[model samples]
Target: MSKKISYEFLEGIQLPITVKKDILEINKESERLLFINKIFQIF
Candidate 1:
């Protein structure tokens, strides 16, 4: 289902050695996605 796809897509990523700002942005976005996933599981 959609949930499994999202989970795997996130899991499949490999972090790059990059600028601090870029890393922070990616972390924030992933955290938001994780929060949304938790909400989906709750309902």
Candidate 2:
């Protein structure tokens, strides 16, 4: 599921470099939130 999103976000190789970088940053932020949520659920 995560891989799908990452691939979709990266599918447009012709986009500006900065936009691609921002997409990666957003992916990282979302993954971080998911990690935190999982940790909280473990308790």
Candidate 3:
């Protein structure tokens, strides 16, 4: 799933992704969450 995300509260989060591959990238920098209100339709 290659979907772009835009939010309001992405400040300072942490992501220790050692094994990099095909994965959904999200900003984990501040107060905002990595995956919050996103819904996927795999119907």
Candidate 4:
């Protein structure tokens, strides 16, 4: 369930863009990392 949501943000990462560029990719990667950290913290 959570993984599905994480993947949603990771998708379309290859599209050319004049947006935040690498920042957006880093943000998505960070989100996944934070989710992992939280899951680990629970144990």
Best by lDDT: 2
| Tens-digit lDDT track of model 4 for 1-43 | 2345545544744434533243344446656657545645987
**Model 3 weakest lDDT span, ten residues long:** 13-22
Q: Write the per-residue lDDT of candidate 2 for residues 1-43, one digit (tens) a residue.
A: 3545554645744656775565556556567446434545987
Reference-based lDDT, each prediction: 0.48, 0.55, 0.28, 0.50
**Candidate 4 C-alpha error for residue 18, in Å:** 33
lDDT of 3 by residue, 1-43 (tens): 2232323222222323331111234434221223332322221
Q: Clashing residue pairs, candidate 3?
A: 11-29, 11-30, 12-29, 12-30, 13-28, 13-29, 13-30
Instruction: Kindly provide the TM-score of model 1 when superposed on the true structure, using C-alpha atoms.
Output: 0.37
Could you tell me every candidate's TM-score relative to the true structure?
0.37, 0.37, 0.18, 0.38
Question: How many steric overlaps does candidate 2 have?
Answer: 0
Evaluate residue 32 in candidate 1 and report its C-alpha lDDT on the 0 to 100 scale. Answer: 47
Which scores higher on lDDT, 1 or 3?
Answer: 1
Summing lDDT over every window of 10 consecutive residues in candidate 4, give the lowest-scoring window. 15-24
Of 2 and 3, the candidate ranking higher by lDDT: 2
Question: Candidate 2: lDDT over CA atoms?
Answer: 0.55
